[model samples]
Target: MTGAATGLGLGIAERFVADGCVEVHGLDITPTPDRVVPGLQHRTVDVGDAQEVDDCVEAILTAAGRIDILVCNAAIMQDRHEVLQTPDELVERVLRVNFGGVFNLCRAVGRAMKDAGSGRVVTVSSQVAETPWPGMAVYAASKAAVTTFTRAFALEMAPYGVYVNTILPGTMDTNQMRDSFAGLGRMTGADPESLIAAKRTSMPLGRMGTPQDAANLASWLASDQASFSIGGVFDLTGGELWSRS
Candidate 1:
């Protein structure tokens, strides 16, 4: 799991550990927490760095003997600029981290899975890939790119019996979401709390989703139950995608 130090990644990792995964290795830019369920190992590295990603995968393969399931959940979202006001560097950085991270990991681990003739890759995407929001154009575009690339990757890997799917997560009370949208609130004159409250109220569930919500979906996708489901995008959007006018 990438970005396993916090939010959705942490939640997903926790769920895997709970499901009796004997060895769960987490990779992230940040250090792992001091305590977690036993057998959870942390390998701190930048996912955007291809060399680092390659080394990390090699280490895991040497240690674990085989790769079974790979989850690419590292991503970043910046909300300060629209297309015109956006800097070239900013767009590149976001794409490099958000999309490139997935690209690097998938190519590295994916090769192993393809060689082994079986594996499951579940990538974390966002609802914004389909639903547009003001000021998040670049982030949304990157996810859109990911979603499309995910489908193509799935097709290529399918011949080897490896299943690849993208999980499109909607708004959730993640720390990253709060921070990004908080700034958005200031600029738009919408109170951050009210905006969040309104979002929750609008959801069919009448509540914002939790990290565990996404984790549960991921766990299901990782299991044998989802074996035949490839080249698919599973929505974990708390009904946000289906919300009506």
Candidate 2:
């Protein structure tokens, strides 16, 4: 699991450990994660760095012998900035983590799964990839790119028995979401919290999704039950996507 330190990554890792995954390895950029489950082994890994990702995968294989399931959830969302105001460096950084991380890990782990002739890869993408948020063009594009690439990767690995699928989660109530939407306060002339609350209440479900909700679906996708499904983009947006403009 990538981004296993916090937010959805942490939540999913916890769920996997609690579900009795033998020797779950959680990878994060942070040296110390917010929470450490007893069974999940936390490792400091910058998923954006291809060399680092490769080394970490090798190490995990050495220790665990085989990685049956790979989860790609590491991503970054920046403060909303219109394309005219965005810096080139910011675009590159976001693409590096949001897209490149998935590419690198999938290539590395997918190779292993192909050789083993059986494995599951579940990726966390965003609904914004399809909806295209106004000021988050790069983030949305990165997500779109990954979702497409993961689908292609899935096809290539299918004959080898490696199933790959993506999760398109809607407005998740996380610290990252709050921070990224802070700029919405400016556009709405309301405080960020108020804007977020209003958005949540306007959702068809009357609430935003949570990390635990994502974990539940991701867990299901990682199981043998989902083996028949590959290259699928599962939506967990709490009915928000259809309701949104």
Candidate 3:
């Protein structure tokens, strides 16, 4: 699990570890995370770097013998801007973390899962990939790529008994979502607080989604009960746009 230091990733890590039967090795760039618990081990890792990811995977394999589940949730939102106004460097940085991280982790971990002939891989992408607003161009594009990549990777790994799936979450109440609201404020000159409040109340489900919503769905997808699902894209968007993915 990448980005497990905070927000949705943290929620998923907490959920998985709460079972007591599972030992979760949570990954994040954070050197130290406050969400300490009995069965969870927080690991410092930058998932975007291929060599770093490979090394980390190797270390985990050496210690754990094999990984049964991998959750790829590490991502950075692009600071809000129009496509023309977005910096090329910002685009590269976001792609490296958001898309490239998934690529690297899947390659390293997927290879191991293939050899083991059984495993689950889940990726957290955003709902904005299909329903794009103005300022989230880069972020949306990156997630779109993730959705596509995860499905294709699933196809490749399915023959080896590695099930890959994607979770597209809606507007969750988190720091990342708040940052997006602030970016929207900068883009459209509307008060971020007002926008945030409006968004929460305006969702079809009558409120913004929570990290738990995402965690429950992701956990379900990674379970043995989800054996029949392959290359699936499950939408947890609280009645936002329905994805064809």
TM-score, structure 1 vs. true: 0.96
Could you tell me which 10 consecutive residues in candidate 2 have the lowest summed lDDT?
180-189
Q: lDDT (0-100) at residue 26 of candidate 3? A: 80
Candidate 1 residue 94 Cα shift, in angstroms, is: 0.6
Ranking by TM-score: 2, 3, 1
lDDT of 2 by residue, 106-150 (tens): 989988888899999998889989898788899999999988988
| Candidate 1 Cα errors over 4 Å, as ranges | none
Candidate 1 lDDT over 1-245, as tens digits, reads 99888888888888999999878999999876534656678889899999999999999999888888899998987866777888898898999999999999999999999889988899988898998778889999899988999999999999998899999988888888888778788678889988787777888888777889988888988889985799799988878887741
* Superposed Cα deviation of residue 6, candidate 1 (Å): 0.8
User: Which residue runs of candidate 3 sit more than 4 Å off their true CA positions?
Assistant: 243-245
Q: Which stretches of candidate 2 lie over 4 Å from their true place?
A: 186-189
How many residue pairs collide in each prediction? 0, 0, 0
Candidate-wise lDDT, in order: 0.87, 0.88, 0.88
- Which of the predicted structures, 1 or 2, would earn the higher TM-score when compared with the native? 2
Q: Itemize residue pairs with steric clashes in candidate 3.
A: none
Quote model 3's TM-score: 0.96
Clash-forming residue pairs, model 2: none
Q: Which candidate has the highest TM-score of all?
A: 2
